[model samples]
Target: MQPIDPHSPGVMPSGLHASVVDQMGLAIGAGEWAAGSVMRIEELEERYGVSRSVIREVLRVLASMGMVESRRRVGVQVLPATEWNLYDRQVIRWRLASPGRVAQLRSLTELRTAVEPQAARLAALRAPVADASELMGLAGKLWAAGQDGDTELFLALDIQFHRLVLSSSGNEMFGKLNSLVAEVLTGRTHYSLMPEHPHDEALQLHVDVASAIQRRNPVDAHHSMLAIMERAMTEMSTLWDEAAHK
Candidate 1:
C-alpha cells in the first residue's frame, strides 16, 4: 500500500487507515473542521470513498488525541484545539503543519523555557562525564556553525545539544521530553524562524552552559541555560509577530 500523504487535500490513501487519520488530523489542525462541527459516518464514508469500518477506526484515533467526540444522537464533533493532546508527537506534528504553526511553535518554546533550564541545572550536578564531554564538543561545533553562518549544521547541533541536556538530567520525567524538544528545534529551522546568522552572545551562552555542566556548577549552568531560552523566546516571538502582520 502507498504511504499516506498528509498534504493530499482529503484524498484517502489506499487501504491505509493511518492515511485517513493523518488527513483528518491535518484538517482538524488547519481548522477545516472547527470546534463543535459534527461529521456523520455516512457522510465521511461517501466523502472519502472509504468503508464505514475504516472511517470508524480513523475517527477512533482522532478521538484518542482529544480532537473529536462521538455522542449517541450527535455525530463526531470536533473538539476545541485546546482539548487536543499537544504533548503527543503526532499531534505536535499536525499542529506544526497547520496555519497556526508559528503559534504552536511559540507555545512549545514557552514550555521548553520552563523545563530546560532546570534540566540543565540537574545535568550539571548529575550527568556522566561522557555526556558532559559530548555536550562540550557539540557546543563548540554550534559556535563554529554560528560563526560560519551554517544554519543547517547549527540547527542539527542545537537540537542534539538540548536533547542531550534534557536526557542527561538524571530525571526520568525530563528525559522523556527529549522528543518534544527535538520537534521545537526542527520546527524553527524548517519554518525559517531561525536567524541567518545566530547571535554571538547566543553562541557564547551555549558554551557557558556546556562549561558549567562540565565543571559541575549547577548555579552557573541554570543561569546560562535560562539566558539561552529567554533569548530564544524573544527571537521566535519576534518572528511570529512579523508573520502575523504579513
Candidate 2:
C-alpha cells in the first residue's frame, strides 16, 4: 500500500492539518519531542504557521491515539511510547518511518508469526470455497511477480494474500490485524528491506499455503505459513546484521 500523503485526496485530514499531524507524529516517534515534553498551542501554531484551531485539532488527533495529553495550565504533554496506541494505522506508519524502524519491524514480524499460521490453519478448515480459490489465484500472481522481480506488484499481492487468509480464518480478531500486516509489508519494501528479487523458496511456500488451504489440509497450511514467517525472520536478521556491520 502507498504511504498516505498529507496532500493526497482521501479520508485523512487535508492540507496544513494533515501535514502538522504527520510532522508531529514523526517527531514523537523519533523521540525528538521526548515523553513529558510540553508543547504549547501558541508555540505549535507559530512553529507550523497555523492557527490556534488547527493546532488544537492536531492535538486532538494525537491525544486520541494516546500520543499526548492536554491540560489547562501545562499545555499538551507528550506521552511515553508505552501509552501510544500502537495498533493505530497512523501511529504504525509514523513508527515505521522513525529511527527505530527495525525494532518496529521485528515486533510486527513476531506478532505475525504468532498469529498468521493459526489463521492459515483455521482458514483451511473454515474458508469459503470462493475465498480459497481467490487465495490460490493470488498465490500464483505472487509467484509471477516474485520471479519477474516486480517488487511493487509483489508487495501489493503479498498484502492481499495475507489479508485474505486472516479474514477467511473465521475469526474477527485476526481479520482486524490485516492493516498491521499491510503496514509492515509496505514498510519492508519502502525501506529497501526486502530483496529485489524474491526468493524462490518464499514464493513456493506461498503457493504451498494456498494449495493446502484449498485442499482443506490444515496441517500443511499451518506448516507452510509457519515456514514463511520463519524465513522472513531469518532474512530480516541477516539484512539487519549486514547493515550494522557496514
Candidate 3:
C-alpha cells in the first residue's frame, strides 16, 4: 500500500481518513499531547488546516485506537498511555514514538517471542532453501559487525534478518508487520524511553538463529530466536512495571 501524504493541501478527502487517523494515532501514542491534555477540535483544525470533518475523522480514528475520549464539554481528553490499543498497526507505530517507548519496545519484543519462533519454523518448512540461505548470509554479516561493535553495520544487517525472515515465512500478514518492526528498531533514539542494552547477547542470538536456518534446523532456529526475545522480555519487564507504577 502507498503511504499517506500528510503534507498535501486543502480539506483532506474522505478517502484519506485512514491516513489521517494513523497520523493522529501516532501523535497520541508518542505523547505529543500528554494525558488529560485537551485536543480542541478547532485548534487541531487550525493546526492541520483541514476541515472539522477531517479533524473529527482523525479523532474518531484515534478514539477507536483507544487513544482518546470525546465528550460534550470535556472535549477530547488524552487518556493514560496504557489505555491505547497496542496491537493495531497504527497504534503500534504511535507507541513506538512515545517518550516512554522502552515499555512499548518491551511489549513488542514480547510479542515477537510468541509469533516469530513459529514464523521461523514455518519459514524453514515453507521457504525455498536459496531464500533461507540468503537471509542466513545477512545474519552472519550482522553477527560479525555486532561483535565488532559497529552499531551502524549491526543495525543494517539486523534489518535484513527480519526482512529475510518475513520473506522466508511467506506470510503476508507477518511481512506487513516488518515495516513497523523496522521503524521501531531503527533510529530508536527518536522515542527512547529505555536504557540501551549492554553486552552482545542480541548479536550472538542472531548468529545462532542464522546458523540454525543455514543448517535447516527449524527447531533450533525456533527456540534460539525465542530465547533472544525471552531475554529482552525479562530485562524489560522490570522497567515496564516501574513505568506502570508512575
Candidate 4:
C-alpha cells in the first residue's frame, strides 16, 4: 500500500476520515465488504490515498460504530451486521444503502410519529416563551420559502422546525432524537415533496402546530402534530413500498 497525505486532496480533510468511515461502512453493510472479510489499512490507505494515520483514524471510528473489529496484531475484521451501532451516523448511512432501507425508514417514521407528537404536547406545556416564538418564526420561514419556489430551503427549514420542537420538549433524551429525526427526513426528502409543489400543503399544518405550541395549549399541540405525522406516515409508507418494489 502506498502512503499519501490525507490533506493533499483536501476537499474536506476534516470530514475525510468521517466520510471514508461512512463509505467503507456502507460498502461493508451493503455486502461489498462481506462478513468475515479482513480489511488491511495498507490497502485502504492506498485506495483512498490517505495516510496510515488517517486510515487508522477512520478504522477506529468504524470500529466504534461496530462495523469493524480491530486488534494490535489481528488487523481490522468486519463484524457481522447484527453487531453494528444503529444509532451511529455512518452505520445508519450504511444500513440505508442496503435493499430494504426504505422500509427501515418507514418504520423509523412510524416510531417518530409515536414519539414526536407526544413530545410536541409535552413541549407546549413548558417550552419557554422565546422558544415558542422561535417555533412560530421557523414555521413562517418554512411557509414563505415553500411558497417562493425555494423547495430546498423549505425542506431545510422544515427539518429545523421539527428539531426546534424536539429541543423545546425540555428533556435531553427528546432533544437527542434530533439526529434520528434528521436522518429520516434528510433521506426521504425526494420522496416527500416535489420541487414544483414543495410548499403546497405543509404550510397550513406547520402553522397550526406552531400556533398551538405558542398558545401553550398542550392538547392542541398534540392534535396538530399528530395530524401532520399521520398524513406524512401514510404518504411515506406508500412511497417507500413503491421504491422497494422497483
Candidate 5:
C-alpha cells in the first residue's frame, strides 16, 4: 500500500530499535531470511550494529507479530509467512515493500472486495447523519481531485472516504479495519499502481456510494460499493499483467 509517512503520529518511533525491526522485517519478508532460518541475538546485534537489549526488543516485537520465534537454544527462527499476523500494519507494510508487493496488493484488495460492500450497506443504514454528510463532502473532494489529476490529494481523500464508511458501519469489527483500507489505498497510489488521473467512472462511483448512504439507501449503497470493488479488481489485474510482462 502507501508508504508510511515516517513523521506520522503513530508510526514506529525512530531509533536503533525501530531500524533493526524494520530491516529484519523487510529481510524476512523479502525471503532473504528464509522461514526456519535462525539468527542468534549476538549475530543480530552485530548485523544491526546495535546492542543486545535492542536486538532482544526487536525480536520481541517480531515474535509478537508472529514473524519470528525464539527458542531456548535454537535462537530466533523466521516463521513461515502464513503464520504472520497479516492484519498487523507493520507486517502489511513490510510485505508491500517486498518482492511480493503485487501479490500482497491483490490479496488485500480481495479482502476489501469481500468486506467493504457490506460495510457500505451497514453504513447506509446506520451511519450518523453527520458522518454521512462528511462522506458526501469527501466524495465531492475526491471527484475534484481526480478531475484535476491531483494524485496526492485524491489518495488522501480516497483513504478518508473509505475509512469513514468503515467506521460508520456500526460494526466494531468493521471499524477496526480502517488501517487496512488506508494501506490498500496508500499502496495503490505510492507504488504507481493507480492511474495518474483517476478514471471518471471510479470517481462517479464514489459519489454514488456517498449519495446512497446519505439517502439511507442500503441496496444502492451495497451495489455501488460492489461496483467500485469490481472496477478496482479489473484495473489492478490489467496493471499487474502489464507489469509482469514488462
Candidate 6:
C-alpha cells in the first residue's frame, strides 16, 4: 500500500502509532488479515519496533472502528467487514486509500443513489423558505466556481451545497450522513478523478435541483438529483477503469 502523504492536509501525520494504524488498517481491509485471524500484541510490538504500549493503543483505535476484538485468552481477532464502522470518515478514507478502492467507490455511489434523491425530494417538501433560498445561492456560487476553474473553491462549495440539502431535509438520519457525503466528494478530487473542467451539464443540474426545491416541486427535485448521481456514477466508473488499467 502507498504510504499516506505527510504533507496532505487533513491526513494524520505519520508516527510509530499512526503508521502502524494505517498499515494495519490497509492490511485488514485488503484481506491480509482475514476475519477471525488472531494477532498477538507482543508480536506486533516486536515486528514494528514499537513498545507494547504503542501497539495496545493502535489496537484500541482499531477496535473502536469495529475492525477487531480483544479476547480474554486468545489474541486480537479481525472482525468481519459487516462489523466495521464503514461510515466513519477515517475508515472510509482508509478504504479509499487501499487496493479495494474501486469496489468501495462503487458501493458508496449506490448508497448515494438510494439516499440523495429522497433527500432532495424531502428538501423540496420540508425546507423552510430561508433554507431553500440558501440552496439557490449556493448553487450559484458552485456554478461560478466551476466556470472559473477554481478547484479548491469548487470542491468546498460542492460539499457545502450537498450538506445543506441533506440537513435541510429535516431528517436526522440524512443529516448524520453529511460527513460521509463530504468524504465521497473530496475523494474524487483527491484521487485525481475529477476532470480539469467540471462537466457543464452536471453544473446545470445542480441549478435545476436548487430551483426545483425552491419551487417546492418534489418531483422535479427528485429527478434532477437523480440525474446528478447518474452522471457521477458514469464518471466514477470511467475513472476506476482507467486507474485499474494503469
> For all candidates, what are the clash counts?
0, 0, 0, 0, 3, 0
| Per-model TM-score on C-alpha atoms | 0.89, 0.93, 0.68, 0.80, 0.93, 0.87
Q: How do the residues 1-246 of candidate 6 rate in per-residue lDDT, one tens digit apiece?
A: 997785454443457578898888988888888999999887887777776767888899999999999998988999998999999998898888877777888888899999999999999999999989999999999999999999999999999999989998999999999999998888888877788878899999999999999999999999999999999999988887887799
Clashing pairs in 6: none
Q: For residues 1-246, could you state the per-residue lDDT of candidate 3 as single tens digits?
A: 987765555447656677667667767766688899988988988876677778876787778878889978889999886787666666666666666567668667766777788777767777888877787688668767766767666667767787778767878887777765676566353443324543467767777877777777889889888887776676567656776798
lDDT score of residue 6 within candidate 4: 45
Ten residues in sequence with the least summed lDDT for candidate 3: 189-198
Q: If both were scored by lDDT, which would come out higher, candidate 4 or candidate 5?
A: 5
Which of the predicted structures, 1 or 6, would earn the higher TM-score when compared with the native? Answer: 1
lDDT of 1 at 27: 87
For 1-246, candidate 4 gives per-residue lDDT tens digits of 866664564333667777787677778877888877888888998888778888887887877878789866877888887787877665666676676576667667788889888889988897999989999999888878877877678778978999988999897888888888777777676545233454356678888888998998889898889887887776766665675698
Worst 10 residues of 1 by lDDT: 6-15
In terms of TM-score, how similar is model 3 to the real structure? 0.68
Q: CA lDDT, every prediction?
A: 0.90, 0.94, 0.72, 0.78, 0.91, 0.89
- Cα lDDT of model 5 by residue, 66-183, tens digit: 9999887888899999999999999999999899999999999999999999999999999999999999999999999999988888889998999999999999999999998899
Model 4, residue 228: what's the lDDT? 79
Residues 108-203 of candidate 2 have per-residue lDDT tens digits of 999999999999999999999999999999999999999988889999999999999999999999999999999999999999888778899999
Encode model 1's per-residue lDDT on 103-124: one tens digit a residue.
8988898899899999999999
- On lDDT, the candidate that comes out on top is 2
Model 1's lDDT to the true fold? 0.90
Question: Cα deviation in Å at residue 184, candidate 6?
Answer: 0.7
Candidate 4 all-Cα RMSD? 4.6
Clashing pairs in 4: none
